[model samples]
Target: MAKRPKVNPNEMSFLDHLEELRWHLIRATLAVVVAGIFAFIAKEFIFDIVLLGPKQPDFITYQILCDVAKSVGLDESFCYTEIPFSIQNRTMSGQFSIHMWTAITAGFIIAFPYILYEFWRFIAPALHENERKASRGFIIIASLLFFIGVLFGYYVISPLSINFLGSYQVSEEVVNEIDLSSYMGLIRASALASGIVFELPIIIFLLTKIGLVTPQILKQYRKFALVGILIVSAIITPPDIASQIVVAIPVLILYEISIFISRMVLKKERKEKIEVKSITKN
Candidate 1:
């Protein structure tokens, strides 16, 4: 839905602005809660099909890896009948807590577009008509990138981490019995962290709009960005070079895309400024 023009914000007091922001936030929260309710109801689907899928050796990614291994005459490390680790709850309330938080996370992910819409509505009053129009479909693009990142994390990063760390053993005496909270934490962090990380282009767009970044600055810091991506990958994935590289590649691609977004923003801003100057001369 298109956001309607808000009343001129300059006429409103500080309290009024706060009140307006509060309502937008409330609506966004409500949307998340509503989506969360659905997630809670569909616990089987979320936990079984979506969340636990990565733990199974026969998962799509694992299957593909196994197939590639056979084709290359390499060891089929991914083709076990089951994963080596088992997830359990240490506390009586652990299961309930995991359920609630997982539902909430799912809700937030599902209702992300609505939340972004509320955010846009809240800020629309402060923007000129042209600026608002130029930012059309911001929510959609951001939502798409986030969903892609979530899928990537689930399909690639989560699986690889699970396969490697879940199967790794320090000695014959040690067993990999992962706690419910720990397992869920890894999945949650992987998915949510990747989603936020994929917002690089959007962040760059906003920075460019505010004149804080340019194509040249991005190019100049490209090497530094690569280092940052590697650091982030190491933090998110297990201590394996393959998983880190897998996670870092998309982030590097996103960084390049961010540069392009910054360039486009600059081009649009300059064209708008030129039009304004031409109008003033006329």
Candidate 2:
């Protein structure tokens, strides 16, 4: 591979920047492909155990909900012996397609940190030394948040949606036999969406850096954010208040944390500016 052209921070050409970005993207893609291959080899564990686990009644999320219902003296409808729906593949090549896609998704999720590292490497050279140091935990924190969101989606959101949708019926004549592709699609969507959503803090950090967002703005728009969060909760969770609230709580918490992160970024920026001014005066 040709060496990426170096771009001076103050006088870098647009073409030079593009060349640097291309190499970073190439590395990131290679990492994902390698991770995907590993996932492909672990098809049995990924599909039978991890993907289908949410459909089982003994899943931990269902168990916890059952306990909650019992404690509240409510109906134990959640404590199901089995989901009413059966997953089937109608297309001749559906199974193979799903396997390939699922492995790719798994690879992306597993290799997320390395991907972020490549992205950071591409951008770090442009940042001041202090800025780079300040963001040293970027990869680790981002990866942790992503994995936590994945777990949340798999254990909470996926099961709730699957159970509700699978068992739901408007008419007794209807039988709920879900397509295999549809089932896997739901799992993939929920997991990936949650993973991205969990990057709120990092998003806020960048927005703060760019002066596009501030703690005040977040606070001022708190009500709107709450409404948006509820809407997102409704989309991700089952059409039940309990499930919506369960999903919304963590998101709201993340929003609050984002506000704090923005405040910290602003504080640091202000302190740095003051020091710079003081040095100039001296």
| Best by the lDDT measure | 2
Q: Looking at model 1, which ten-residue stretch has the lowest summed lDDT? A: 1-10
TM-score of each: 0.95, 0.95
lDDT of 2 by residue, 1-282 (tens): 656455575686787778778888988999999999999999999988999998888888889988988998989775788888899999999999999999999999999999999988888888999999999999999999999998888888899899999999999899998999989999999989998899999899999998999999999999999999999999888889988998999999999999999999999999999999999999
lDDT of 1 by residue, 63-177 (tens): 8878887898988664677888898889999999999999999999999999999999888888999999999989999999999988888888888888888988999799999
Per-model root-mean-square deviation over C-alphas: 2.7, 1.6
- Return the TM-score for candidate 1, rounded to 2 decimals: 0.95
lDDT of each: 0.89, 0.91
Q: How accurate is candidate 1 locally (lDDT)?
A: 0.89
